[model samples]
Target: MSSEKSKYIVSAEWVERQLGAPGFRVVDASWYLPAQNRNGAAEYSAGHVPGAVFFDQDVVTDRTSPLPHTVPSPEFFAAEVGKLGISESDTIVVYDGPGIFSAPRAWWLFRLMGAKNVYVMDGGLDGWKREGRPLQTDLPEPAPADFHANFNPYAVTSFEEMRGIVTTGSRQIADARSAGRFTAKEAEPRAGLRSGHMPGARNLPVGLLSTDGRFKDLASLKQAIEDAGIDLSRPVVTSCGSGVTAAIITLALHSLGHEDNTLYDGSWAEWGGRTDTPVVTGEA
Candidate 1:
């Protein structure tokens, strides 16, 4: 199967060829903002890749947390993903409606949960459909498999850890929110949250890292990040409005062979929503 930027990102043609291959699993990881007016589940019900299962981001989260889409515990993740007939050893490929958007989050999560060889489908289902690849409206009843969760606790940065990072500048913070939101020129979608970003954070805005739902090449990825004032050699922690799009930055970093990175699980949803944490406006 051919890949695009990295081995973790496979082309739609490759994914189509791997359909129903033994120990290969496909997951539709589509999600959208309320303003987008798109329903991932409803769209999946209409039609999706054959033998693909939906990974409901809303349901597969830490329900106990007040925040939206918090990463669930290892035990909880194991139980939920196991029901989808996915094992840690399986060659899992995840895709979203807009390709690289939400798919990287699933790819990050799968890797965090210790599923090696996980990949994101380049161009997503949108590209798959545009290419006129096979799609099925019928949902397959997959036999449940044992998904052993070898969770890596260090992959995610906690609120407290983020606080220290901001205070000490221990790691460079790369925010994935839009330029308007990051600069406090636009109101945050979620009410009761402050506008702007962390004090020392760089405004990478996830859009800079991709084009038409596909990630940029390694050189372009590096250029976009460097233009945003981020040093690839230093440690970085990715953040977003919630924790979703931050993964796109994480994927970009990983694609460039930058391994000293982690995703802040709480992100702006926790930082901007709180009065205790510091927030600033007007670029970086």
Candidate 2:
């Protein structure tokens, strides 16, 4: 068994034990692209981790943004999460349907909001179900609590910051999009966006970071990053179609005990859509 550890991720057995434990809360951060045709709320309604609140990714974002799933204001996050009775003091464990995909976004959201004890449930809800863990369909009516969000501006990246990084070579860029999208061979799911990746960015496709729907162990994850030609010692900024899968990179890096990384919230949705920013079509 690999003894490697990630403070940002917890195993199903660990969460089972922590269930009903004081100061602990579980959140079903399930979400899917429109192409998937899966309703996150519907799945959560059918069955979910006991006491787990559903964190709707679509609604928990900046509604004003034209792109999808943009991070919402700290006040909005606090209020939204507070409705589920999650406070700053509570240890929040987040999970999604397919392991290691959407849950990382929720984990990153909590971290960006300055959450102290948020973790992504390793193997996610799918793995939990496969293991015969308990589930519940009834939603809990949580008494609202005050979630005082302390936003960490450094945890996220902006389009202007990405431009500076590309120009200065200050940070290594990683794209969580697939190889096709990264190579410009495949059309973007979102219309009007250009094909290709940000210049100097490495393709880390979020799916490659996992196995059997679960994230790989720390050693394998380190190898994956190294295989992408990314210098393990340098900092990384993760990007994706709309900043969703990018969190998978953030989760992987955090699992490796890496700290000098951030997620580009706008990602390619903003960068590729704009004609001003330089984009490269081809492999790194």
Per-model TM against the reference: 0.98, 0.96
lDDT (tens digit, per residue) of candidate 1 on 101-199: 888999999999999989988898888999999989999789999999999988899999999999999999999999999999999999999999999
Off by over 4 Å in 1: 1-4
Structure candidate 1, residue pairs in collision: none
lDDT of 2 by residue, 139-233 (tens): 98988989999999998898789999999989999899999999999999989999998889999898888876667878888888988888878
User: Distance (Å) between predicted and true CA of 22, model 1?
Assistant: 0.4
Q: In terms of lDDT, which candidate is strongest?
A: 1
